[model samples]
Target: MHKYFTIFKDSYYGYFNYLWSEITTFHWENYFYGLIVVSLLVWGLEILFPWRKNQKIFRKDFWLDTFYMFFNFFLLNLIVLIFLSNATAQLFNDFLGLINLQLSDFQIVNLNALPYGLGLLVFFLVTDFVQWNTHILLHRVPFLWNFHKLHHSVTEMGFAAHLRYHWMEPIVYKSILYIPLAIIGGFDVEAVAIVHFSALTIGHLNHANLGWDYGILKYIFNNPKMHIWHHVKELPENTEYGINYGISLSVWDYIFNTHHVPYDGRDIELGFEDDHEFPLEFTDQIIYPVKKKRSKSA
Candidate 1:
């Protein structure tokens, strides 16, 4: 009991201190500043070369999405997730000790010993592949899709919309990614940070109002032109879940036969078919999925 209490208290203070450092630090790895830099850069691109010319600079639900970004990134994680995750992890570790099992046993190879460039490439590719599969589950799983709908509610996409998602989402992604990353062993922190920032930049651009395919690279990388099709309201024929489930890479979609971009999606209607009745208020949106599931089960 005392251990759980200490974990909760420590996480509360530790998370705030971490946030303060991330904001005060001037170094390249500061995620707070990195988010600001990437967001502004993408917003500039949207301003200079917007594909949706009629959409206003401050598009619909802009402030809402901005709040969702910060809330999901900082506040929600601190207020609820950190304490719970820390406690759960501690409990899991304790249970493993009882069984004389160790997580280290699952590791396969030491990635840090590899050449820097090669290790980074391998790390990026492996992580992105995990992300792509996780993204498909979010779309195909009925229970998970209830939470993921918050992201697709965007009527006018922008850079900030990239971060707008339900609070449970990071849990889903991180929980699934943990084992795969651990198995690779000794991934350099710097390499992971660089890949994270690169992916962040690409994600912002993917949701930006700029229509860019990266030409031939579109086959390898996901771009705004390809991602817009993912948010199209109507389900394409013969497919039920969704298409274009790629994250930072489009190669997986191509390999899995989930890729589909029949034409320019610049003018396509975004959001799910019944999004008209989706809650616009944050509290309502957050509670909606829970209430809906409970009602159905009853």
Candidate 2:
């Protein structure tokens, strides 16, 4: 009994130490590897299992998407980190204070403990749900909609289009979604890393042209079919807004009555009608909305 107890304790401590290390170490190369693999997977799946017969990929699309992806991953992220980190930190602190919540206490279970995995999974699911709801709220609220509509204006749904968001979004919206998780404390760096990769991979997969039907998987995962509907250009046609809202899981949409499935085999045109007049150049997209809003007010 004594020997068995010693073995268990050592294993538990080892796992805990590993988890702690994963949280503290930042590996840029690993992040790049993840981004490349996800992009290729999206491209390959689009070629192999396309959902829309009429949707065509072109070289211009490829280059444009690449530019947006690089810009979002590097420059936009840096801007948010520098300008919004303190604001986000304060918001998180206030939120926790409001809830009177403290960090979850980590208990030592064995290396292969079920509780550890369960805790991590729960944390991931909860965070994704929060993000999905926040995303929906941004769409529904008009002031916030001003910033978010820039994303919806993209008439294309491809790997690169994922980066076509307003600069303020990551700071204002996405930052708040992660703060609760950060405050919880027991969530280690590896879990956070896994969640980030999983969210981006599943989000890209949803944005791809893949033809796979999620079936019941739609209940748990946000597959491509469900998300494509969110990009549908027709006004009333876009009503099925609830499905596949989770960055990875679809459950949040179902739970919140936002889950939508695509019907009507015809290619639902993508992007706003007004977007046609806008310049495709990156600098123009950044300033276009602001100019339009100002013109309208005047």
CA lDDT scores, all candidates in order: 0.89, 0.65
Worst 10 residues of 1 by lDDT: 84-93
How large is the C-alpha RMSD of every model relative to the true structure?
Answer: 1.4, 10.1
Model 2 whole-model lDDT (C-alpha atoms): 0.65
lDDT of 1 at 276: 86
Tens digit per residue, CA lDDT, model 2, 1-298: 5644554555455544644454456464355556777888888878776667567865336576787776676555444444355444555556667888532322233222347778777777667767777887777666667766667766656666676677767766666665455444446667767877887878778777666647777777877777776776665544643234456777777776776664742366776556677667768777876887897899
Q: Who wins the TM-score comparison?
A: 1
Clashing pairs in 1: none
Model 1 TM-score is 0.96
Model 2: lowest-lDDT 10 consecutive positions: 103-112
Stretches of candidate 2 exceeding 4 Å from the true structure: 1-29, 87-114, 237-244, 262-266
